[model samples]
Target: MALEGAAAPGVAARRGLGMFVVMIGVLISAVDGTIVVLALPAIQDDLAMSLSSVTWVVVSYLLVVTVLATQVGRLGDMYGRVRMYQAGFLVFVIGSLLCALAWNAAAIIAFRIVEGVGAALIAANSGAIISELYPPAERGRAYGFNAFGWSVGSVLGVLLGGVIVTYVSWRWIFWINLPIGALALVLAVRVLRDRGERVRRRLDPVGMITLGLGLFGVLWAMTGLAAQPWGGTQLAFLLGGAAMLVAFVLIERRQAEPTLDLSLFRIPAVTPSLLASLLQGLASFAVLFLVIMYLQGPRGLSPIDASLLMLPGYVVGAAVGPFAGRLADRWGPVLPATAGLAVSAVALVVFALMTTTSSLWLPAIGNVVIMIGGSLFYPANSSAVMKASPPGRLGIASGVLRTFASIGMVFSFTTAILVAADSVPRSTAFAIFVGSTTLDGPLAVAFTDGLSTAFFTMMGVMALAAVLSAFRGRAGSPQRRPDGRAGGQVPA
Candidate 1:
């Protein structure tokens, strides 16, 4: 069944509020993610953390969120999306407070895990909520606004971190989230009145456990590689993680209600859109980390300034979101998504060509182009995933989409470590990544060479993604139905 009590296009005001609240939710997560990168050096100093422990501060959160995404979205399907989503805000606020007050490395990692649970809930459900709220004809527009929130939050992460960390305490970064979360939670309560219908399905404990452990093992090994070289421990973790993932696929096929409905891949739109999301995340996030490290270590820029060089991309991307979404609503996802990937490749090529003496304008211009490409790609792709999903399984579909999206990011962490370790000592590269130190002379040249290799490699990955985007068949577009309605009932 379709979600109960969804807002129609005529109710512009309520829909606007609905969009506003969710976008704010998006902003909260994005800000927290980017702001922490700037604050990591401070946290390391304050807690006297080892390099591995400091890395865990970020890795722990990503691992938890990635693991819990599908499960939480399934819960949203069974209970209520808005109810679960609101609860995420409350949990995140508490986590943020605890993190602000943490006295040691262990405490911070524990608090971050708590926060990740909340973030998982939020990320898994945001797209579903948007699908439920807006009619298919206007979903792209709503999602575009959602992208705006991400852009604004990322921009603030850089701009605010520069000012706050330089002048105020790094602890304030966590504390600042309290008010934001509180406000978002209250607004969500007021705006999200529609409750989705409950689906009667048993939780897939085996699937969840296997999938979670598989991810945890792989992600942990990747993070560990940042501090050390390939060894027995890393090999064991990688092989074990791969085995668990294989088991998850096999087990899922036998379960009546799997943690993820593997059958969803049969939908032509779903497969390509999900792949596009995954590839895009891998390419973009790796570049983001690589670029920041380059500016910070080799060029000796502050964390904020290094981040600022990429600001144009985020800002311009946000500006492009709604427009691209509108075009997707009118045309379809294939053109926009393919074009986005192609443009990103061009951006990466620009980065590959840059030199130590190159103007900051080179990076800035490339970033803006990359953002424009992403702005074009993201909303349309997300909307396409939702469009291809059946109404009854929107939550699962959204969850699966988020899972696919995050996969690239998790892999990007591995990619970042592998690439950075090639040019400099793993520890030194990691410290530079977190804004703790700088590089000079031969070391800087080596790091920049590694950066060039990574960028060119990413360009190739994006080009491949563009090909997949082009092949994602049109199945469930707004105009696809014979009755000339805004949506068609997707078959299970």
Candidate 2:
């Protein structure tokens, strides 16, 4: 039998099936992104990699995804989103199988790049597909449900990664994706229908190449800067990356159909929402990464234990997001966005004060606060971007928004690595693992202090985000909706 949302006659069942298919793809892709963190040590042991090299395992995935996200979104618009979505699932499954069979770190990282590319395609189009499936009135609810997949996936990644690593080999972490991915692909093909007309525009080869290379350079430099000396190969990469990025900007300005529509920056609502997303990413992504390390590395918590500790925070946030989206629908984006950022800033401060000797409640409380803040902002920010974008350009706008968020994540990770590298000794990286497992001695103090510093930096970043969020379009502005409806005005 065909899934619910297939082009079959049954409307209700088809819609439900379509939503499920989309959410499965979303959750799995997101879970894969973070699940590897808990498995990092296992991977290192298996491959005999240095701490710095191990980081590339994560960085490679992120960099490839971030760079290609916008391009893939555009491709979805030119082709059909359903087609792209199915292709993404197939590619991701192939990548997962490659990762599971990898013999070394280099091979795994290479395979992860393939996975990242697939992930980018899926992420860039998931929301666009949801919007196509649901009417405007119900779209908010549908998007809220989609966001839950992201939040739950993050938590599941940590929890499942722990479980898999504890009982199974690290390779199982990747192997797990195959069956789920295949299921998603089958459901998607059976449910989601092709919607858009295939446009036959020439691909902007120069624009695509420049943008990809520029992003790769920047992300590469950011990831490597901390591990390599300032005057060495890292610095050269940074400079080269920056120069290429400059060339990209210049090239894009002259292109008739640039991969990225630079003109979108001119839109009043789009600019603030994009900037807010970027800042939110910079401030928040590193916070979670460091927290996982702190809990599993220095606090002597097992992977499962640490995942459980973080459960409350993610649950609270995910629960509140739908309500926050409703509030945005009524009040406007500014109040919720500003309030969320403020809450996040406060949470970061609390998080910064946490030491090994501090009560566990402190960190838990801080995490909850940050999640609450994020849930408030995310849906609202997304709504604003959709409202501001033209209907014909929804896919492009989504791409831009996602690209900014991905870039923010890259920056956050890079910053965390740089800061942690300075605070923790390269040789004693294993000490962190030992202290985390034992949780009983002076080594715990050192590990906690390093974490505290990392949290402090994250707090500073969140505070900066708060300041920027306040500048989001004034309350109660008559924002233009993609559907040209005044009833969708953003509240001041």
Candidate 2 lDDT, tens digit per residue, 1-492? 112243556776778789889889878976897688778878888887766677778878887777777778778788877888889999999999999998887998999999988888888887677667754434555666666776777777867887987888989989889989999999899888886655543356787677677777767776565655565676777778888889888988888767677777777767877888888898888777777667766666777777678778877877877787666665566677778888998898888887776777877888899988988888777766666665556667777788889888888887776666565564454334322244446766766677777777777767777676677664333345667533444443
Maximum-lDDT candidate: 1
Q: Native-vs-model 2 lDDT?
A: 0.74
TM-score of 1: 0.95
Q: How many residue pairs clash in all the candidates, one count each?
A: 0, 8
- Candidate 2 — worst ten consecutive residues by lDDT sum? 430-439
lDDT string for model 1 (1-492, tens) is: 123345455466777788898998899898988888788888999999997788778878877787778888888888888888999999999999999999999999999999999999898988899998887777887788888888889888878877777889888989999999999999989888656678876788899889878987787777777679889998899889999999999999999988778888899789988888889888887677777788888889987678777787888888888888887777767788789889999999998876677787888888898988888888889988988888888889998888887778878767787788878999898888878889889888888888899999899889988999988878765564565445553332
Instruction: State TM-scores per candidate.
Output: 0.95, 0.89
Q: What C-alpha lDDT do the candidate models reach, one value each?
A: 0.84, 0.74
Lowest summed lDDT window (length 10), candidate 1: 1-10
Model 1 residue 440 lDDT? 85
